[model samples]
Structure formats: C-alpha cells, structure tokens
Target: MKKLITVFILSLLAFTAYSQQADRFRFQMDLGAAAPKGGGIGALVNFEPQILVQRNLALGLRFGVAGLAKDIVYYDIPKDFTGEISANTSFSGTANYYFNYKKGKAAPYVGAGFGYYTFSSVNIESTDIDPDDIGNLRASFAWAPMVRAGVELGKFRIGAEYNFVPKSDLQNIAGEVIGQSTNEYFGFTLGFFVGGGRWGRFQ
Candidate 1:
C-alpha cells in the first residue's frame, strides 16, 4: 500500500511537470450515491485533481469514500442472528479521454482507474451468540478497478462509474473464513470544476 501511494505521488509530480505548458489544472469535487452489491444505496464523495496534458487527454488522482449498509437476518436455526454489513473507503488514480475538447460545448468522456480499497467487517449481533464469541471480521486489502463515463458542460460535470472488487473471504480473529463478500458497486456523481488554460481555440 505504501509503495502504491508513493508511485502515485511520483507519477503525479512528473505529470504536473510535463503539463506545465498544457491547457489547465483542474480541481473537482463530486458528491453522489453508491449502490454496493446486495446492499442499499449509500453516499459517495470524491476529490480529484487533474492536469490536461493534451487537447483531449487528462491525468488525475482520485480520492474517494463510499459506504454501504444492509441488514442481515439468519433463518432456519433455532437461534436468530441479526446485524448489518458496512463497506467504506476507496481511492484510485484515473486517466480520461474527452471526445470533444471545445469550450462552451458539452464534451463526453470515458475513463478507467485502478486503486486500493479497504472494507470493514460484517458485524453480527444475536440473541443466541455470546458477545465473547464475536470477534473482528475483517477483509484483506483489495485491488479495485473502475470504469466511468460522463459529460462535462462548462464547469459542471455528471458521471457514473462502476467499481469491481473481487469476492473476498471474511476472516475472524482465529483466521477462519466465515463468509465472503464482494465490494462491487455503481456510483453516480455531480461535480463542479474550475481550471484555467486553453484547449485548442477555446480558452
């Protein structure tokens, strides 16, 4: 994780240097919703800093957090178990390509990102199980991949993205696999961005 963060920072520095003569540096904030697999809709937030290195290409770093929660109940047993599952904190680096780079006109874009994700464990509380038997149920660090598409109009942007994190086994304090979960979700965002520079004839 440390190595990955280091690499992202170094690459951002290099890109910033290379974009010195480019069009603009963009800073954007996104607020949206996330729908995780088997979970209800949750809130999502993202902060991105990007530099346009070309007429149609931009490189950026994305830091975001999303949370999902769902209530669970166990049946078919004499003892009843009920609790909730929560997932949070995702960060990534992204590159986007704009189809039309004209100012004052809406430009549609597509992008992909890769990053590290951490998720909290499923917490279960039941009338039958003792509190002592409940231990931390944690998930390992997961490699996440995402794809996004959006339209940018003037300073406003709206987009949707889907993140794919493979199924991870949930482990207890005894290192026993008790269950498995996948951190896959779809998100929609609305953002406002500010930047200065010229892309072609549009300033």
Candidate 2:
C-alpha cells in the first residue's frame, strides 16, 4: 500500500505542475464495479486529474485500485477455496478526445491509456485447513492497455472501460509457477468532476 501511495502522490504532483501551464484543469473521482474475464466481481475506484490542452483534447493521469474475489476449485479434489485472489494498483497516462464541446451539450468521448499494473500477493483461506499451511501467492507486473468510451453530461460522466493485461504466471515462495491468470477486466464507472475552467471552451 505504501508503494501505491507513493505512485499516486507522484502522479498528482505531475498533474499539478502541468495544470499551472494549461488553460483549464479538471479533477474527477470515480466509483465502479468490475467483472473479470473469468468469473469474478470486483470494486474499482479512480482519481483522475486532467488538463485541457485543446478545445477537444484533454490529457490526464489515472490512479486506480481494484479488488477481486473468486472461488477456486480443483478438478480431481473437491474442496472449497473462495477468497480474494486479486488486488491491484494502476497508474496510467490518458488522452481523450471529445466529439462535441458545446456547453450543456452531451459530449461523447473515446480515450486510450497505457499503464503499469502491480498486483498484490494474496493468501487463500480455507475452512478445512489451517491458514498457515497455505503459502502466499504472488503475481507479476504487466503492461496494461485500456480503452474507454463515455458521455459527459454537465458535471457528471458515465463510462465503460476495458483493461487488457496478458496472462501472468503466479509464483510461490520457491519461485515455482503454480498457476497462470490475467488481470483483465471490464468496468463501468460513474464520476463527477469538481474543476474545469469552463464547460466546453478552452483558453
């Protein structure tokens, strides 16, 4: 969590420095739900700081957290293993282009971003056995590409996004590959922006 905080602070500072030079700034907070490719549900939260670089173009940094839980079952053995399997922090740079920039008019936007995703280690707990016997599961970092489309109405924005992360092998304390899984997910978000110099016009 400390590493996540440090990355967020650095990204925020970068946004602040760029905001001073830009004509307009926008800050957005988002809460959403995510569904992974397999069979799991997760919660997502994001903080985005953006600057309008042009009338229809904006650049921003996205700091996000996601936590997912799912059930794991073995084919030969019948056992119940259900717990949080994935928790991740993401930091990305984004660029968005708005189709319509008229005030009070709904603006549709399509955006893309690239980022690094850091997944935390998770331990699976089972009621049948002692938790200490189960080893910690570690996941690797991957480069994630994101694509999103959204509509901004007044100060509120609704969007859907897809994250593409390749499958990464999970490792144990002995550095042996135990399983392979991807962190890819689809998310729907509702957000509100607090600051923007003007609704549609850029200075």
Candidate 3:
C-alpha cells in the first residue's frame, strides 16, 4: 500500500508541473459596453497580455479605451443638460487570482489594478443654450484604481469591472471652470484568449 501511494503522488506532481508549463502566457481581447455612473451607455475594448506567475495566479497589462455619456454639473448655474460625450483611454497593470476547483473546467478569478486614465473634455449641449454656443469641455488625466471579478471557461472569459476615477473640472473653450463630471464607470466584457492551456486547476 505504501509503494502504491508513493507512485500516485509522484504522478500527480508531474502532471501539475506539466499543466503549469503548457501555456505560460496568453493574450486576451475583450469587447464590451460601459455604463457610466449617472450617465448614458458607452462601449469599450481591452487588449491584455498575461503571464502565469503560479498555479493560481496570473499577471497582466491591460490597454483599454472607452467612451461614456455622463452629465456635467455647473457650480454657478442651474443647468438642464441634454446630450453629452466623453472619450477615455487607459493603461494599467493587473493581477488575477484564479480558483479552479479540483480539475473543474471553470476558473473563477478576482483581480485589482491601478492605471492612468486620459479623458477628453466632455461636450454637453444644454437644451437651454444656443446650438453654436456649445464648447468642448476641457478635461485632464487622472490615476485610477480598478477592481474586477470573472469566470473563465476554457478559452472564453466573462468578466465585470469597476473603475474608480477622480472627478474632473469641466472647462469651456475659454478655459473657465464651468462644472464637474464624474469619470467613473462599470464595464462588462465577453472575450476569449489564445493560451493558458486549458483552465482546470488539476487535470
């Protein structure tokens, strides 16, 4: 019985090493919609390159871009806003921890990241203002934090993330501070990856 157990343990260890080395790295592409806090719907795309650091941990760098339609709040004037748009681009370093239970095909993960975000000035045309009077709201770059959770089944990945971004001052073409707009958003994604050699914890 002791001899049999020893052989089984060795076999398991070999298999585990093989699994980890099969695909040490992978690339992922995700396309999804973003819902801004107190704003209209938008879309985003993310490109990530990931390296497996351990059996249950991976590290990645994400390049992402998104457009959101959020409101602008004026400090002096009581404004009734109508249409709005803001463009955002970001680059972040991320780490994911996976939970693949007992060779199960599905791997669930939670992760966190911090990135630099660039925002284009939001343009909002109030129904009360003149049509040609619309000025591009000036914006600035910010450093933000992100949190995400997801499940990966084979090559396909489904995930959701929230970006905590700082609010920026809305300035007109004259460079006068007019109001503020929240740059935070929630994103949902459905995409697939090219590596990581089958997502089971032990198989």
Candidate 4:
C-alpha cells in the first residue's frame, strides 16, 4: 500500500512538472474490474501521465495496481487450495496511436508496452489434517509484456488490457517449491481524466 501511495504522489508531481505544456500534457486515470486468467475476479486502477509528441501519438508512463482472489489445484501433490489472493503492481512505458482522433471527440487507439510486474506474497494452506501445517509462502516479481486497445471520448475512457505475466512459484520456509500460481490477467476499464485541451489531429 505504501508503494502504491508513493507512485501516485510521483504521478501528481509529474503532472506539475509538465503542466507548463498544456497542449502536450495529459493525465488520465482508469478504474474497473480485473479477471485473472487462472479464474477469478477483482478490481484494477491505473494512473498515467503522458506527453503528446504528435497530434495523433502520445507516450506515457502507466502505474497500475490489481488485486484478485483465485483458487489453485495441484494434481501431482494432491493439493487443493482456495481463497488465494494476489495483488500486483506495475510501472511501464506506453505508446498510443490514435485513429482519426480528436481531443473532444471520440479517440480510438491501440497501444503496447513492456513492464515489470511485482506480485505480493500469498498464503497457501494444506488441505491435510491441519491447514497451518504448511508455513507462509513468499512471492516474487516478473518482467512481462502487455497490450491494450481502447477509446477515449471527451474526458471519459473505456479500454481493455491484457498482461502476459508468468506463473510464480510458491515457496515455503525451506525454499522448496510447494505450488505455482498463474499471474496473467485481463482488465476492463472505465474512467475519466483531467487535462488535454479540446482539439483534433486529423481533418
């Protein structure tokens, strides 16, 4: 949570630093639901600060956080787990190109980015006689690629994104692998932003 706050503050500071160039500065936020590829659902939120280098092209830094609840089943070890909550954070460089886009009108875009994903530690319990027999597990981070497509109409945005994150191993106190958790997910967003004057790129 502390890290999330720090990143948000940095985003605001970025806006302040670049606010001088109103025509080129853009700050947008998106909030909506997230569905894990492994089979679960939760919420997602993002803050992006951008610079419009060209009328139809913009580059930005995206900071996002996602949380989900999932269940993992291991056939080999005969492990059946439930209620595993995973939280992930990301910071990435994004480039978006608008098609027949205008500031106040509908702005349709396709985007791509590469980023680092940090997954939070999760607890995996043993379905044996006692659940506490197994110790707590620690989570590790991964570097993954992502893609997004969406549209921005006036100050509102609706988009969809996919994160191609790798599976993470759950390790116990002895550093032995107990199980694996799927980390990839899909996010749907509906949000609004402040900034970017009303204008159009193409005639």
| Candidate 4 clash pair list | none
Off by over 4 Å in 4: 1-19, 73-76, 101-104, 125-129, 197-203
TM-score of predicted structure 3: 0.82
Report every candidate's CA lDDT: 0.72, 0.77, 0.76, 0.77
TM-score for each candidate, following the candidate numbering: 0.78, 0.85, 0.82, 0.85
**RMSD of every prediction:** 3.7, 2.8, 12.4, 2.9
Off by over 4 Å in 3: 1-22, 131-134, 201-203
In candidate 4, residue 69 scores what lDDT? Answer: 76
- Tens-digit lDDT string for candidate 2 (39-137): 788999988888888878889888889887754442223653555755588888899888884654578889999988888876665667454544677
lDDT of 3: 0.76
Candidate 4 residue-wise lDDT, 1-203, digit = tens: 57656875786687568657657777889999988886888899988888787778888888888987776654346655664665578887788888753435788889988877887777655555244544676667888888999988777889999989888877766887777888888999998877663445442
- Residue pairs with backbone atoms closer than 3 Å in model 2 (clashes): none
- By TM-score, the better pick of 1 and 2 is 2
lDDT of 3 by residue, 1-203 (tens): 24333543564455345445567777788989998888778899887777777777877777788888766686656863643654477878789998875577788999999988887756666656653554776777789999999998888999999999988877777888877877789999999998773765442
Query: Which one wins on lDDT?
Result: 2
lDDT tens readout by residue for model 1, 36-108: 6765667788877788766778778887777765433333234424444464666688899988855446878
Alpha-carbon deviation at 145 in model 4, angstroms: 1.1
TM-score between candidate 4 and the true structure: 0.85
